[model samples]
Target: MSSGMAGANTEQPAGTRRNRTSEAGPAARRASRATDTNTEERVAVWDAVAAYVQEHLLVQKGVWIPTFGSFDTISKDIRTADGTVTLRWPVFQLARNLRAMHHLGSDKDSLPAHREVETLKYSEVAAAASVTWQRGKTCIQSTVSLLSNCLKNGENVAFVLKDIGVLLFEGMSFGIKYYYDFLEKLSGKEKFRKVVFKAPWLLDTLVSRVAPVASLTHSGHLVVFPM
Candidate 1:
């Protein structure tokens, strides 16, 4: 991605900080942000931004950046009956959350629970807690814009999301092919010791929610009573 925003490591004044266009105003903030930048700064910003998104994603249902859109997962229920189906896709919806954030005029609907994920315990700093959020988010928007530039420049482009996938833009089409398989990403894991004693996994019903009526027979019949 191209150079985004400003220096990611630029130390701010030692005092209270907040997420806003500016303490002074949008015009002043815009003026304060220098136009000149380089690839290194953008990459730093992106790395920080990607880390922030990954953190929020693990704890919350989804996360939204004002201009970048939404980062969330698409889950599919997996049950014994629904045998073959699997694989939960980590989805990146372009500009959907931006419109929503604008109409609502709040971060309530857009962002994940900020205070819930702690920097001390989880080593996660919420968007409001650190400058990283805004800086990273700006870089995210810049990253998207970089992909958009391809269509204008007429070139095939791929944006690498570390540990996630490569976002491809070719022939005026866009899609993400993930290198990591978030298979059954949200599905509950079985506590083998506690659950297996009750019933073997094959016979367990409703994702360990309900008792199985019978064991599966060799002939594929239900045997309520073993003998």
Candidate 2:
């Protein structure tokens, strides 16, 4: 039996012997367990991140929440006696309110609103507003293209939500409205059209309509009137 044991030990390859010894050690077992656990944890985290991005950030309207900031989305529903119609949010609401208040308040109500508008233009206001400038710029460009396509194609109306912007138009008679919303609901739900504009007068009107201040560019933009 002793002779047989000696022969068996001698016949074993050095690499195989080393592997057996290492596998029997406590450190090796611990390392193997840790590698598996790490792999599983990474997979779980990645899956969660993907789910979060798709469900919340991939819609027609997307919202980016700045660090320590909150975002919200709103939709307006119009129900008439005949049927239900949904309008793009923030647009009609802001536009309608501005028109109404402009008629109702006249000069008396305008002064107070102007003061707030002045504050909004201050450097501090733009800096504090939770808007990503680069992102907003991209939104503007995408909206422009989408609207142009709709116009060129002779479509009466079209709405597109890109990562950077939401484009809404109502044919040749009206200008397209663009803005970012912090809120997003389920599919088929129409969001209220609350868009931030680059124009100062429009911004002031938006501020009066309860739209939060957002970062906007200082460069003057030219809008060519249709012939």
Candidate 3:
């Protein structure tokens, strides 16, 4: 009778182990299914949003989607010896998504958060400027002044363009949007007749400290010479 009781006790443990295994199998399968469903839903959402952006916002001017990226429509003015032509174009932005997903994942947080992202293709901005803001009298004056100064004084003007923003020449860079506008204005009217960007760094350093020159001395307007 004692030998029989010992055998029964050992058999009970085996029976219990089988029961536990059977119970866990269904639970594990359920958990896996939940994870898969969640993944599918997230993928669908992303796909829909991407499609919407491509369909609607792709043609608008300066239209940017928050946290995802931006879309821009840019116009340009062409100049030939005979006449001028204006052209408009569009481009998409996706840098913010790439930066957020890949760069900012670790503890060493270097990239800005998604909310801080302000997306614009540097080319679009430059093209817009060439179409619009470059036409301003002040902008034209500044450009002419700087270019003239560089040419006259034999100063080396460096254009440091890193493919992200406007054509930044030398130490300072101007936005492409404004540059485009300036170009358009030049195409429409004769530039450098009134003002020119002859010496930007020098003018900035001196004008900031010295009294304002009423006009470029060569123009013969009442002016204060930088003595």
Model number with the top lDDT = 1
Candidate 2 regions with alpha-carbon error over 4 angstroms:
1-136, 160-170, 174-227
TM-score of 1: 0.44
lDDT of each: 0.36, 0.26, 0.27
Per-residue CA lDDT of model 3 for 22-118, tens digit only, reads: 2222323233333322223322332333333333333332445443334444444345444544433333343344334333222111222342323
Error of 2 at 119 (Å): 12
lDDT by residue for model 2 over 57-82, one digit each (tens)?
Answer: 33423323221111122343455454
Candidate 2 accuracy as lDDT: 0.26
What is the Å distance of residue 13 in model 2 from its true position? Answer: 69
How do these models rank on lDDT, best leading?
1, 3, 2
Residue 204 shift from truth in candidate 3, angstroms? 40
Reference-based TM-score of each model: 0.44, 0.20, 0.22
For candidate 3, the per-residue lDDT at 166 reads: 17
Candidate closer to the true structure by lDDT (higher is better), 2 or 3: 3
- Model 1, poorest ten-residue lDDT window? 218-227
RMSD of 2: 27.5
Rank order by TM-score, top first? 1, 3, 2
